[model samples]
Structure formats: C-alpha cells, structure tokens
Target: MGAVVLIATLDTKGPEVAYLRDRLASLGVDTFVIDSGILGEPVDITPDISHGELARRGGMTLDELQHAGTRGRAVEIMRTLVTDLVREKFALGEVVGGISVGGVGSVMGAAAIQVLPVGVPKIVVAPTASGHHEFAPYVGTKDVMVVHSIVDILGLNPISTTVFDNVAAAMLGMLRAGHPLGPPSADTRYVATTMLGNTTHAVEAMKARLAELGYETVVFHSNGVGGPAMEELAAAGQFVGVIDYTTNEITDPLTGGIHNGGPNRLRVVGELGLPQVVVPGCIDFSVFAAGQIPSALAGRPVYDHNPEYALVRTPEDEMRQIGRIFADRLNSATGPVRVVVPTRGLSIPSTPDGPFWNPAADAAFLEEVRANIRPDIPVETIDLHINDPELGRHVAELFSTILDSTRPKEALA
Candidate 1:
C-alpha cells in the first residue's frame, strides 16, 4: 500500500508535524512528509521532500524564494511547486491519502490535493475550519475533508494528540475502503442532470425514465457548488448527455444571489459538444439568505423557501437578459442541443395563482430566447408545470432522440 502524505511548514510547525508522524506510524501507516518552510531550519525531523528541493523543482533556489520581496509571492511559488510534486506522486501511485495540519498548511495542501483526481482521500486539520472562514480555497470543487482542530496546532498535548490520532485512523479507514479514481467503464451509459428542491419530483421521474431508456442518471443539485462540480465531471467525460433542468444559477450572477455557479455554469457540456437538453427551470427567481435581501427588490414577490433562504421573483428585464445569455451560450454548441420550456410554470412558486406567478415576465424570456438563439436549434414549449412527471418523461424522450442521432451506427447496433 502507498503512504499517506503529510504537509506542513516545518519552520513553525515542526514539533506538531513530528507528533503526527509518530501517531500515524503507531497505526501501521507509513508516512511521507513534505516541508514547505522557506526560512528557518526544520527542528524535530527531516522531511522526505525538503523545501530546498521544492524550490529547485520550481526553478529557483531557497534563497531566491526567501528574497521574493513579499511573503505572499513566496507562498504562491511554494504552493505551485507542492501542487505539482503531489500530482506527480499520485500519478506514480505513491500516494494513498493526504493530510495538511495547520491554517497556512491547509491552504497550500488543498491546492496540492485539488490537482489529484477525485475519490482520493484528502484531509485538512486546522483551527480555521471551526470559525467563519470561507472554505472554497480548502475544498474547491473537490471532495477534500476538513477537520477542525479544537485547539491551535502549536505543539503536542493531550487534545492535540487525540486529534492527530483520529486523523491517522480516519486516513487508514479511507485508504482501505475507498474506491480508486477513474472514469466509468465502457459499458456504463451515464447521463448527467441537474435539479433543485422545487423540481425534485420532475428530476426523480426523469431519472426513472432515463433508466428505462438504458441510461443511468447522475443528478446534481443546482446549488452554487453542485452545478460546477457536475460540469467538472462532464469535462472528464463522465456522462453521455445532460438534462439541465434547474438553471437558476444563471440568474444568480446578475442578482447577487447566493446560488451563483460562476460564469462557466452553462458553458462546459456545450463546449464538450455533448448532446444536451436545456430547460429554464427555476429561472423565475434569485435566492438569498434570510434578512439578506437587497432593498432594490423590496417590491418584488418573495417566497420563503425555508427559514434560511428567501426566493425573490425575477422581473421581466432580468428574465430577458438571462434568456439572451442562455441563447448566446447555446449558440456555441457544436453538437445536438434542444431548449425545453414549461409555459405553465418554471417553478412551484411561479405556477398560476402562486406567489411568483408572472406570465408577462416569463413570456419576455421566451421571446428573447427565440429571437436570439440559432435557427437550427429547436425550442419546445409545453403547457405542464416544471415538476410534472409528463414533462420529465418528455425531456427523457428528447434526450434519447438526440443521443441516438449522435451515436455511430456501429454503436447503435
């Protein structure tokens, strides 16, 4: 079995790192340590990979990094170097898991582990994980686990010892049981799809229908992270096609909503030229946490999604803008694509007699999309609600048609 890699800045964290190394050794796990310190000499132990060698691999001497004019610049250079080193080690099958043991270590170690493929067990133990720090840098779009060390990682003590012990044990468990990273097998036909609480029933039905069509569905929630993570997997060739059923992430960037999936949300699968069915599901509103609603939207209809989130209805103008954005992105698709719309409602709250019902606003989006999208792509509109099982079945049939059209005749046989 390969060893678990431990990362830390040895200058300031030598004693703590040394303690963690011994703890893992007692658990029958081999350890490979990397020192990212740039200034002082390592105190308690020698690392398998030293900072000096790390600097050399990055095309500079340790002294050159130390004199890089600013601490941030030096850290950036070391971070990139460590990331490349870890990637190479994983590629060579030398890494079973990874652990990073301090605040700064968490940041640098996360960059390294993010370069590793999915399903690799990566952990970050830091006091910062307990507080109100933004975790995007630590987890990014990967599955890295973050453990909050109850006390600061200054030195060995009873509390710190217990934490390090558990970290080692957890790594061992994952290394023994976790699935290895790789793409799906040739015979496994998987389809990627997205959904939200508002459209759960529809997606469930869609999944069943896709299963009946001899394809398995990997459904992603349309939360801020889920959409991008699905796209990342799609780019890795993990799916045959996509049913983008909940696309409110597109309205998020313009409305400052909390569910924003960044600018690349709808671009990846299209760029890959995968057959896709795009729906404007949940596009009638922008989401915000309670008490965080902006004053500009004071007069708009607000639906209380829960105690934590409020959904504000999008107006006609914003819907038109979203429509154009969707059309422009879809126009760049190099493969089979279709646009499906539910004229009765885009979400539960936008149904007739619902709080967010506004046919004029919805119609504005349809007009803009039809006007701006390419003439070859077909746009289908139905009179059912977005969550209707029939709507999901219809989408499944549409995706099947496109997939059949794109497959080679030999594969179809």
Candidate 2:
C-alpha cells in the first residue's frame, strides 16, 4: 500500500500534524509529511519534505521567501511548489491519499490535491471549511472533501484530536475501499454535454439519442463551475465531441450574474480541435439572487426562478453583444463546429406567452451572430422551443454527422 501524505505549515501546525501522523502510524498506515512553513523554524517535529526543499524546487530559497515582502507572495510560491511536489508523488504512485490541516495548509493542500485525478482521496481540515468561507477556491472542479476543524489547529486538544482522529479514520477507509480510476475503455466513445434546468428536456433527449448512436454521454450542469469543469475534463482528452446544450454561462460574465464561467468558458473543446455542436440555450436571461438585481436591470422583465434566484431577461442590446461574443469565440475553432439557434425561445420563460417572450431580442442575437461569425461555420436555425425533444434529437444527429466526418478512418471502424 502507498503512504498517505500530510501537509501543514510546520511552524504553527506542527503538533497537530505530528499527532495525526502518529495516529495513522498506529493504524498501520505509512505517511510522508511536508512542511510548508516559511518564516519560523518548525515546532515540535521534523518534516520529510521541508520548506527549504519546497522553495528550492521553485528556484528560490527560504531566506528569499522570508523576505518575499508580502505573505500573499510567499504563500503563492509555496502553493506552486507544494502543488508540483504532490502531483509528482501521486504520479509516481508514492502517495495513496492526502490530508492538510489548518487554514493556510488547507489552501496549499487543496491546490496540490486538485492536480490529482477524480478518484484519489483528498481532505482539507480547516475552520474556514465550516460554511463561512467561499468553497470555490478549495473544492474547485475536484472531489476534495472539506471537513470543519471545529477548533483552531493551534495544538492537540479534545476537539482537535477528535477531528484529526476522524479524519485519519476516514482517510484510511477511503484508501482501503475507494475505487481507483482505471484507463478509459477502448470500445466506448464518450461525448461531453452541458445542461440547465431550462434546457433539461433538450439535453436529456440529446443524451438518449447519442446513446442510441453508440456514444456514451457525460452531462454537466452548465452552472458556473460545471461548464469549466466539463471543459477541464474535455481538455484531458476524455471526450470526442461536445454538445454544448446550455451556454448561459457566456452571458453571466457580461451581466455580473452568479454563474460566471470566466473567460475560457467556450474555448477549450474548440481549441482541442474536437467537433462540437453549440446552442444558444438559456441565453435569454441572466440569473441573480433575490433582491440583488443590478439597479440598471431592475425594471426589465424578471421571472422568480425561486425565492433565492431571479432570472432577468437579456435586453436586445445585451443579446446583440452576447451574439458578438459568441461569434468571436466560435470563429476561432480549430475543428468542425456548428451553431444552432432556437428561434421561438431560448428558455422556458422566454417562450411565446411567457413572461420573457421577446422575439426581437432573440433576433438581435441571431443577427449579430450571422454578421460577425466566420462564414465557413454553418449556422442552423430551428423553429422550435429550446426544450423541444425534436430539436435535441436533431442536434444529436447533426453532431454525429460532424463527428463522423472529422474522425480518422481508422476510428470510424
């Protein structure tokens, strides 16, 4: 069995790290401890991978880092070094699981473990994990388990010991019974797709049709994180094509909606030269929390998705801007790409007779897209609602045609 890796800032968290290491040892588990502390000497224990070695890996020394001016810069250096170390160890099969204790340790440890594949066990024990801090930085697109320490990790105490003991036990259990990720199947061709509540029926229908066409479908919620996560997996060579059924994340960055997918949202699969079918699914609106709509958009049509979320319709000008953004991103595609638009509506609330019914705004998007998009890329329009099953099946067939044409002759067999 491989050893479990423990990470901590040894100057402050040494005792807790030692206690957890000892507990794991008592349970017959081997461990390698990494000290990420920068300023002071390690307290109460020695680390297998000292902060000096970590800094040298980044072409710097402890003296240099101690005077790095800002704590943020020092932490950034250590984060990069530790992340590389953990990734190397995991690649070499030297570590089976990883745990980090305390606040700074949690951030560095989570960054390190994020490089590991999905099945590896990674845990972060920190007071910040207790529902108070935003978890996106720690959890980001990975299967990291964050446990609240309950008490500050200054030293071993009743509460701290219980948390460490439970964490050790949980790590051991995961190591013993967790399923290891194996190589992808040679016979299966996987396709990645995105979806939202507004485009559920369309995505489901596409998934079913893709399955019938002998392709496995991996569906990702097109919320802020899910789209990027899907892109990450796609860049990892996990899928042959993408059915981007819901692209609302594209509008979030423009409107300051909560589902912002950042700048690289729609560019990954295209950059990888994978055949992709794009849709303007859910582009008719931007979502905001209740009572949080921007003052500029307050008077526009709003649909209360729930008490927590309000969907504000995208005005014509914004839609036109979104269309230009879409065209720009899609124009750079390195492989076969197709854009499909649902003329009747882009979301349930935007359908005819619905609260956000605005054909002119939808038309504005289509018009801008056609005007600016690369002339080589085909733009197909369907006179159907975005959720219509027939539209989904049609896109699936369209994707199949593109995939078949682009696939190597050997792959076609």
Candidate 3:
C-alpha cells in the first residue's frame, strides 16, 4: 500500500485534519490531504481540487455554490466531486485507504469512499454516528467503518484528539494489513444465495451442492437489507450466480407487507445478467404492520411468529400483482434467467392445515406470470413443495446448467 489519502473539508476543520495528516506521518506513511470545501480558501492541501473545479463540476460559481447553499447542499456537491475523484484515484492505485472527518461533511465524503469497491479500508470519524441510522446501513453494506467522534467538530477537545488519533492509527494499520483486492484464487468464485428462516433448509441444501462444484456461497437473509446487499455484490462482479430462494420480500412489498424488497429486488438479475434461478419460495403471504391488515383479511388467517413478524394469507387479487411484478422484472432480462414455481406449496406456512395455505392465490400468481412473461424466458413449475429435497435438486440443476451454458467456449478465435 502506498500513501493513504486523507479526504476532508480542510477549509473548516484545518487543525483537526492536520492532526490526522501529522499522525499518519508519525507512523512512517505518506499522506495527501485534499480540500473539498467550496466556501472558504483551504488552509493546507497537497493536491487540491480548487473551488473553481468544484463549482464547474457543480454548475455554479464558487461564491454562488457556497453562499446560496446550506450545509446539506454543500455536502451533496462535494460528495459528487469526491466520488468521481476517489474512483479515479482508486483505479490508478494511488489511494490505499481513505478517512474522512466531520459531522455532515464526513458523511458526504465517507459516502464517496463507500462507493469504492469493498475490501478497501474506509473509515469515517463523525459526531453524528449515533443518530445516523439511514447512512449507517449503506456504510455497513460497503464495509465502511464509522467511528463516533465523542465531542463535537467545533474545535479539537481532548476526546476529539484521542478519537481522531485512534482512527488514524486504525487506518494506518489497515493500510499495512494487506493489499486491496488480495491475490487471486482459482477455486473461489463468490456465489450469493438468498434465504429466509422458512427457506433456510432449501438454501443450505443448494449451497452444499454448489460447494461440491467448487464455488463459495454467500447466504443473504431475504430481509430488506440482505437482498439489496446481495444485488450490490453482484453488480460489483463478485458473484458468478444467484440462487434466489426466498421471493417473499417481493410479496411483502407488493401486498403492502412489512418486509418489502423495494424496487431493486429482482432488477439485479436483469441488470448484471448473472445466471439466476428464482422461485416463488415465500410468496404465500403478505407481511404487514400488525395493525395495518385489512378488515377482510383480519380474520381470514393470521400467524404471529414474533412481535416484529406476522404472516397473513395473501388474497387471490394480491397474488396476481405479485406475478405481474415478478414476470415484468424477469422479462426485462438480457441474460440467462429461470423462474421456478413450487406448485404444491411455496413455504411451510402454505402447506395444508397451515394458516396461509391458499392454492388459489398461488395459482393466480403463477398464472399471471405465465401469461405475461416473455416467451423466450423459461418458467419451470415443479410438483414438489418448496422445502422438498427434489425441489432443491431441481434448483441446483437449473443453476448449474445455466452457469455451464454461459461459459465461453474455447479456441474460436
């Protein structure tokens, strides 16, 4: 690892930024401090992107971009510039690790670093870490470490110095630890798999089978964050294939369930064009806020596994929407794709005598998918239940076939 770049708004936090730069020097590492503040002149910066370039990229004059802006707007503009600059530096292998310091400013700068490929040491020392729930998840997903600045960023206090010094030491240690993007291995190709508590057995089976074929499997919980994080990894080209076992979150999202997958859930398969085999594994129910269940559905069927999780039978109408959404996302694919439907039952709760065991709803969902999906796309419907060993085997076979089919044939050139 070469010199670690210390990125911050050196205009306002000059003293604090200087401490971090000096601390890195003490540890026998070179440091480049870049100033991103557009309001005032920078105190001390080695390789600075001037206010003029920031304003030019931001489409505003330096004075206008600074004076007309609140802290948030300034942060947003700075973030855009920083994201572009950091990506460029990373590609050139000039930056080993990145550290940012500030309250609002730190979040913006850290966010830019977060956009960098994972495994690079990313640290943010911010006073707002305690209440930053929204930004925290993005940081965690990207493996960016956030350290709480004990005192405010107004000036350097004892606590502030201690915290910043520790952060500097940690960053130094991370840079020295290993090179970013470690030595390549022939046997390991990361495979991301989605699973829920109900679908864990099938996923485990599939993972074991995939491992036999010489691929590592990363299992993601089908909760809100898990699915998105998996897609993120896929977009980064880290995963070779995806076995999406638990499509339950899409049901939650469509039927106003509490655990919706948002708009990005199934889009990654289309965007990245990775070999994917999806199933209607958990589309049997619509999760919702306990009190939000409709009057018609209030007593039809309900199961409360815990305070945070409750299952309600999905109606026939809701299933049709789920099918359309599923088919629509799948149809947009330019890559190899497969949709598997377990006709007998999609989840444990959808079996006979279970609370959400409604075949009509499941049938309606599948029918809509069959009716709307592109003819070129393959939709496989199996007779076994979702948890069936045979169903797991079928999933493995489809993924294996699709992945094998995608490998480039040799000696054509």
Mind sharing the TM-score for model 3?
0.83
Candidate 2 clashing pairs, residues 3+ apart or interchain: none
The TM-score measured for candidate 1 stands at 0.92
* Best-fitting candidate, scored by TM-score: 2
Per residue, candidate 1 scores C-alpha lDDT tens digits across 241-333 of 899999989998998998898998888888899999999999899999899999978999999999999999999999999999989988888
lDDT tens per residue, model 3, 1-413 = 55666677777777788887888889887776667776777665444456567677668787777776587776677778777777788788887778878776776677677766667888888777876444653274577788888787767778888887898888877877744554336656777888877787777788787777766788988766678878887876778888888887787765566667778688876777788888888777766555667675656578775676777877888889989988988887778888899888887777888877888888999899999999988888888888876777678877887888888767112
lDDT of each: 0.89, 0.89, 0.76
Work out the TM-score per prediction: 0.92, 0.94, 0.83
Clashing pairs in 1: none
C-alpha lDDT (0 to 100) for residue 4 of candidate 3: 68
For every model shown, the clashing-pair count is 0, 0, 2
Off by over 4 Å in 1: 37-41, 63-74
Look at candidate 2 and tell me the lDDT of residue 287.
88
Cα distance off (Å), candidate 2, residue 382: 0.6
**Candidate 2 global TM-score:** 0.94
